[model samples]
Target: MRLIPNMISSLPSSLLRRAAFVVLIFGGLAACQKNDASAGQVTGTLNDAAQAAGQKLDQAASYVGQQVDATKATAQQNLDSASAPSINIDPAALASSAQANLQNAASTANAQLGKAASITGQGLEAAGRKLQAWSAQNATSSASSSASSSGSSSASADSSDAQKQMDK
Candidate 1:
């Protein structure tokens, strides 16, 4: 009779305790899931500093460009003021020097040609003497051969007559 009411009251209290525990556990898990923004904040600040440094670098490049233009203009002015030296050559002297060199070369060539001609003449005389000696040698050998052939035929005729008289 009293057990039913007491059991129903205890049920509500138990449900309430479980809901509170679930809420605490979900809150802990949610806290773990959330991202830490401190590192991102630091990196964002560094990116901004880098962009600022790039702007300064661009300004410095502009200053360098202006200085380069100034240097170029000054160099052009110096080139305009400076002059190259001019020289005038004497035509007669140039021609006489060239003529003297040509005369020396021609004399050297003429002397060499005369020496070569003298050597060629000596070579021709020696070759002529050698050819005449060879011709004389050949003529003497041919005359001796003809005389020996005539003597050999006469001896053969005398031997044949002596043999016929013996046979008779």
Candidate 2:
């Protein structure tokens, strides 16, 4: 009991406040459970609450660590810049390099576009030939069917005429 108070006093004020808040919340929940819950149920709820609080504290610590690291890096960069020598840049050379890169990209893009167009045209030509062949086949089949139907109708007319002559 004495050690616990000493440890709590050693913690920063902000951390102590946060710890007190977590305790108050879980304590209220435990009090509420004591009214309608078994001892085991209250214990389980406390366990879960403790675990959640621990996870939240861990996350807060990790975030603070990351912020500290970022601040340190920025400070280092500022110090380095203060002591580093100035750099000389040639604008003309930079412009020439940029222009060369742009031209190369444009040439590569044009070549790819040309290849795509050629492939598309070839695909269209093949599709057109297939369509033409299918149309010709359908036309020939329809014409033969029409001729066979006409021949069958003429034979039926001849058979009717022969039946009429026999009745006379």
Please list the C-alpha lDDT of all candidates, in the order they appear: 0.42, 0.46
Write candidate 2's Cα lDDT for 1-168 as tens digits.
133224223333444355456546545544443122335644664565556555555554444444344434544454455465694445455344434443443344344334433443344344335534554454445445654777867555644553343233
Q: What's the alpha carbon RMSD for model 1?
A: 57.2
Best by lDDT: 2
Candidate 2 regions with alpha-carbon error over 4 angstroms: 1-87, 151-168
Clashes of each: 0, 0
| Regions of model 1 farther than 4 Å from truth | 1-88, 151-168
The deviation in Å at residue 47 for candidate 1 is 97
